[model samples]
Target: MIYVIIGILILAASFIWMEIAERRIQEWEKEK
Candidate 1:
């Protein structure tokens, strides 16, 4: 049960991280 909770948290964090990364990439492209 604990492992399942941890897995979910990790997945959520990674998803959020990816979103932030995508936004940053877009901003960078605009600057170019």
Candidate 2:
């Protein structure tokens, strides 16, 4: 269960960061 929780946490962070990076890229594109 601990391993599962850890995996989920990592997966959530990966997705959240992916979204943040994507939005930042979009904003950068708009600035160009």
Candidate 3:
């Protein structure tokens, strides 16, 4: 049960990171 919860948290973190990275890339492109 602990491992499952940990896995979910990691997945959520990865998705958030992915969204942040995408926004940064979009801003960089606009600057360019």
Which candidate tops TM-score? 3
TM-score of 1: 0.87
What is the alpha-carbon RMSD of candidate 2 to the true structure? 0.6
Local accuracy of candidate 3 as per-residue lDDT tens digits, 1-32: 99999999999999999999999999999999
lDDT of 1 by residue, 1-32 (tens): 99999999999999999999999999999999
Clashing pairs for predicted structure model 1, backbone only: none
What are the RMSD figures for all models against the true structure? 0.6, 0.6, 0.4
- Per-residue alpha-carbon lDDT of model 2 for 1-32, expressed as tens digits? 99999999999999999999999999999999
lDDT of each: 1.00, 1.00, 1.00
Model 3 has an lDDT value of 1.00
Clashing pairs in 3: none
